[model samples]
Target chain A: MTLTKRIIPCLDVKNGRVVKGLNFESIKDAGDPVELAAKYSNEGADELVFLDITASDEQRATIKELVRKVASVINIPFTVGGGVKSIDDARNILLNGADKVGVNTAAIKNPPIITELMTLFGRQCIVVAIDAKRNYDLKENVNIFSENEKKFWFEVFIFGGKQGTGIDAIFWAKEAEKLGAGEILLTSIDADGTKNGYDVLLTKSIVDNACIPVIASGGCGKPDDMVEIFEKSNVDAALAASIFHYETHGVKGVKSFLKEKKIPVRL
Target chain B: MVSVAIFDYGAGNIFSLKNSLEQAGASVDVITSFDKPNIYSGLLLPGVGNFDPAIKSINENSKTKFQDFVEEDTPVLGICLGMEMFFEKSEEGIEKGFNVIDGEIVVLPSTMKVPHMGWNNLEIKKPGTILEGVDDGSWVYFIHSYRAKPKFDDVITAESDYGVKVPAVVEKNNFFGTQFHPEKSGDIGKIMIQNFLNVCKK
Candidate 1:
């Protein structure tokens, strides 16, 4: 197939401004969502993801307006995830112009909502965001994978990757797909914020098991990290935060690097 | 100023499509049904929602009006499910299509994933219409599980290899269709939309 691998920039937003993390309320604002989104779209980034870590329901309305502003400025595809709790939430974001609605804790808390979202908004527009962490407390009857002699199963996390759910990430991915999830956004809690590289072993395992397109998220520090993941896994796309947020590299520069590495990108 | 009407299937995807068209220098109006008089210069069938429901939505209010638009050559462009609906039938849904194209929509081979999603290059066959000024192998964004198999291959102006030769772009007289979403297809897609607007201007 002539399909090229995608490079997606993840923006963490709160109260209409892009932020670095949820805990850093005092950290300086990263950028405007609409402006950053437009910059990424113009720089050849294939797609974008906006994660609203804001916990308050009162301010959620602002996120939809933010989505509208970004959608107006950019032409590429974007997925918006701001604690999508119900069909109404997904509908609000989608109606505001988000191409796909990403559900994380909602899907974990009520698995049936996956099928419900899929039925209401076609499978293509539903994204099941799975924030999985490597749980070393080896449990029985779980899909176990290991690295460096450490045997563990990737456990699904909810509440913005703070709480662990005993559910196996690998098994949950298949369940999500069977439950009508159009795509899976697989994030490694252990790899996130590390800025070393992607957890290729974890990403590759999920990619191999799921027939749906998987986006490998977290742990991207440099262009080489992206190169390593694409070279290692069959994942359709790679999502990064700090690299783009911190201005380490532009989306165009990353794509040029990927193209040079013989990895197919939109550029 | 030229105006384009986007036939909203209520799939919540018209936002970017509207933005891209506006960026391409065309005023846009979102129309949910064709029962109303066609006021726009060009009509666009957006690619969103399930096949059956979208067809049902169209057949519910304005089937004949849409057919007339296609038959009389009013310059229409259908994207993804929009393009698939013009075929004779689809494996995704039991409802009959618009029959504008002599083809049937079928599931992509099991060898590949269900939804052929992402940016794939076009293997330009005989270029014109939306593919004008677009380079051969220019990438476009796509997200669909079903592909159309037209009875006449000549109607397919561009195709992409996905185990099967998936028709990427098709042009049959005043009617045009893309299996991929040009609005989501980055800079190259902008050019295609601008080209479609040029047709609308005429």
Candidate 2:
């Protein structure tokens, strides 16, 4: 047997509640972070990631409380991301009990923090989250991918995918790994929220270049979508949001389907 | 409830281990060193922090009594870095290990990735160790850069093939160890944790 590919259920948290901007009565108690975490952990999710979208000062303590509650209940690997800028921020999250911390905008603005976090926390616990958008305005000396008579390169974006950094995502991924990041969390802004599927080209490009494990985030709508990404790219894990949060598919059902299709997964 | 304790390295998180241990039916305590007389029915060396600092902490915390626990029949469960420190020395750091078992720690082969950080299946070489109920080829969570190089090959009960014969489970007398973090390893890990606690009860 080989190292199985992971399936991660990502929950968007705002002020300590799992937020999706969409009403899903399917969720028990409507966005109780602790409940959803334990549910996913028991549903055969390989891991769980919570993207803290809350930006207030109170969010710091609230996120820690949610983390502690989630940690107390779930027995799976959990990662908390968003607005982690300094070592103190990471320590607060980790000491309260997060297995890993994912940094996106902050690491893009100041890349040295990746090394710093890795030095303070073990590399295994520091995951550098990269938000990338497809820039069809192909430029010189950038990794490019083409599909359906169109050629484009991925451009890195920061600040919840609202700001463009003008840096190539592929190059930045390698640079982050070089700077001692243990893993890379790659999210495709182009494919996100669009149920079509993940940006296979973007995921494959990053996985091919990254020696560290890569988690493909955004644009996974079904088990088939996961099968497509895993079949086309050797991504170590796949992260999904609304599809799971809204009960479109259960984590165990998705893994069973993938297993039937010959993808190794923990059952 | 039978009592168990985890020796904290002063750095890194042990909440998961502590919580999982509690779920596995034991009262868990976080200890710095073996200063107090051994009240624990079982002991755990958590898989976190760097080797040098962790060993330094372990050294500071009453090695003579801790060594007595290892020499006697107090089941000790070491995970990842916890398992690595049982050897004489490690390539990751300058400090030496407890020399509990005759071996040393070294980095994964250069051909493979430095940190084999993910889920891998164990190829059980010898059974009836701490992994008594564990099935062969069972998947578990692992996150480590260095591996054990034991002087006695028979000490290894199971190993994972990560382009190298990476030892997964090991046992010498009542002392036991796993290179993977069973706390994060889902159902299979639960079985191993339960089995370790069972040994403690015995």
Candidate 3:
């Protein structure tokens, strides 16, 4: 049975503070991860995902501690990602009470990470995160373009969305699923901070092709954006950082809005 | 005391199933060894992961005690792989099941997706006591590739459409099975669980 998941509030943590930006740039301190997670949980957020935006390996201990703190007060399922590059890292996060571990760079670099994690922690514990940007071109038959291009469709990005892998986003999502990823967390680079709305077309491409749960991230300006994704795309959850961080919309607000739109959400 | 013994072979969603049972007001005891099934009012066999390994583990740990419990008319509930284990044999592995139900576990047709993971509506075939308050169209969460095809169609209590009549819920006296994850199906799932607990009470 396909019961819809409630809204999810994502917190990008760097050096123990919540930050938000487009394509992982122009960062601003949001707040404490523990405090923000608690607020959202109290406001009826169904789940919370924490991504440590830093690339340094030293932040591993800090992220694990952060996961332990957040898991203590938050009863809902929480997923921790960012800088998780190995099976031991995934184990430590799960041991710290994280329900799932999100892998992006590691999964891209080593496609076998999904199978290894699933073998150790089970399929439900592994989630593959995709950070994608539109790759468009004015020239005929060119579906992709370099970062210097003026018009682009959606190009897959890695390493905190700073480097383009030049791989098709749809192909990557499908490969990740085939590799035993239980769920796919799709973050649109184009809609990362515009608040205009999620790139519904980009989301549809991944969600339609993949059988696993696809989380719609980036470009969430209002509750209506969530409704549009749920109504139009096959996305299971709508993830946003700025809206929930800035208190533009609480978990309850989005749940009520989705419920009114005939979308199922846990009240 | 309404204690429900959850057989944990380290292969399934044991914690979530225990939590759901607890939420339904049933005291849940996760039993790793099948030495004593008589102590609990009911038993839950929840399975995840591969088939052969799961069957081997169950046999090595609690097969004798489980068979004895079923013989004594103890209420037992199986979910997903657990339901598949209730059949006579499985195609994934050469091993035979507990034979609690007259069926065989076969791989789903290749026409549909391998793992049918999603929410689909349940079509109530023969509404048993365990499905008392559940509406026919109520949806449940499912995640599995292999399913049991029972020789007796009357054994099916509820079925879901996934290119074929996938058995959503099955029953034969005290033995019950759910192909869907009732623990993850939210309120309706809780309701179905509560109904199963009611059967145990009788």
Q: Which candidate is the best by TM-score?
A: 1
Model 2 scores a TM of 0.93
Best-fitting candidate, scored by DockQ: 1
**Candidate 1 local distance difference test against the native:** 0.88
Candidate 3 is scored at a TM of 0.77
Q: Estimate each model's TM-score.
A: 0.96, 0.93, 0.77
* TM-score preference between candidates 1 and 2, better one: 1
Quote the lDDT for B165 in model 2: 91
Output the lDDT of residue B44, model 1. Answer: 95
Query: Candidate 2 residues A188-258, lDDT tens each?
Result: 98888777788898999999898888999888778899999999998899999877888889999999999
Model 2 Cα shift for residue B63 (angstroms)? 7.5
lDDT of each: 0.88, 0.85, 0.78
Proportion of native contacts kept per candidate: 0.79, 0.50, 0.08
Regions of candidate 3 where Cα sits further than 4 Å from its true position: A1-22, A25-80, A91-100, A120-125, A134-155, A162-167, A208-213, A227-237, A244-267, B23-27, B35-38, B62-65, B90-95, B106-114, B198-202
Tens digit per residue, CA lDDT, model 1, B91-138: 998998888889899999988976888989899999688988999988
DockQ of each: 0.76, 0.62, 0.18
CAPRI-style quality class for the chain A–B interface of candidate 1:
medium
Model 3 / residue A267 / CA error / Å:
8.1
Query: Which candidate model has the greater lDDT, 2 or 3?
Result: 2
